[model samples]
Target: MREDTTVSALDSLYLANSIFEGKLLQAAAKYPFTVSNFFKSFDDEPLGITTSADGVLIIYWWDTLTGGTQHAYSCVAQYKTAHGIKSVSPASPNKYSCSYSKIYSLKSKDKIYYLAVYDEILSYHDRCQGIQIFLIDKDDLMPAKLIKTQTGLHSKIDYLYNDNSMRDQNWENELTYHEKTQTLTIPVALENGNLTDNYITYKFNGEYFIKLKSK
Candidate 1:
């Protein structure tokens, strides 16, 4: 039993390595992909990077298996002195059947806030359900302290109703950021059948998110 457990652990590690390497290489090609353009190819977009004066922080989704349950999780990697990119922390502690898809940085004076977008597992791909907002110190990137959480946002495709008739039919409830205005737009579903009719905008006030009136 002991030997079997050890072998299983080794196998799990190997699987994680193989999965992450392929996904990382695939995602690395689109380095520094901005938040607005990311949701356009949301399924294919697996990695997000946030850079600071200190170093670069990367967050990518790597699938893993544990006890016969497969996990699509977000993993953290950072640039080292001469060692290149290395994993600095464990996978995000998301509940089973949930995974983080992308990370966005909101610079507020001396602070940088990381907004991690995550979704419930209805399929193998990333279809946003909500967001987890957090931040990390520029000097130390291990612990990503969560500041806020917002739910009930849907980026799922309406396969039954959507057949490409409407513009952005696939991404009805998408999240986007306007760098010029420093505004983060979150699409929230107002009515059951009304896909993308309502939205909420927010701006980082150097400490927390301040809701802005709809314009």
Candidate 2:
């Protein structure tokens, strides 16, 4: 595992060629798989990787910083069997101008994955935080839905804003969906171990979002 001090430590990490190239090359040689170059341009943080149901690997390039109201681009290679390169495609092109920092390929009945993004604001003497999420189908790579809202301030001060207002703020958030119970859970925890949980049950007809609260 390689580490760098570029963006925040929360900035994702990518596997290096020297680390996984041997195993990947061995997999390609033994199995009927292809290898292609995956490329993208950004602040050079870590890259995300996940496998499809058919054993195809999907790589995601995540940008740590919110690009000043600009959208970041990602490119992925979908390999074909017989160990040959086939095609390259865009993950999210011209969708929205936000930061998708975390990507997860879900193993659920609905066959979908999720990307979590957020807008961060740091005070001179306080903590920084933000929020954004996306749900897309695994097969088509089409965005099923998106949530671009802020949470709340993360500082030492006890200042209060419009609690009922629906504007974006900065806070910690997580997204996950359960296949068996068809439930999505977003549990928020603070520094004191106080926890709040929010749940959403899905029928898989379409995409949906659930609010998370931190105690």
- Highest-lDDT candidate: 1
lDDT tens digits by residue: candidate 2, 58-93: 433344343333423333434443434333343332
TM-score of each: 0.50, 0.34
Query: For residues 27-78, what per-residue lDDT tens digits would candidate 1 score against the true structure?
Result: 4433434312223554665443443334444454444444232344445444
Model 2 clashing residue pairs (backbone): 33-83, 117-132, 150-168, 150-169, 151-169, 152-169, 152-170
Candidate 1: regions farther than 4 A off:
1-55, 65-71, 79-86, 90-93, 97-102, 123-127, 142-172, 190-194
lDDT of each: 0.47, 0.35
- TM-score for candidate 1, please give it: 0.50
Clashing pairs in 1: none
Tell me the deviation in Å of residue 9 in model 2.
Answer: 26
The alpha-carbon deviation from the true structure for residue 151 of candidate 2, after best TM-score superposition, in angstroms, is: 24
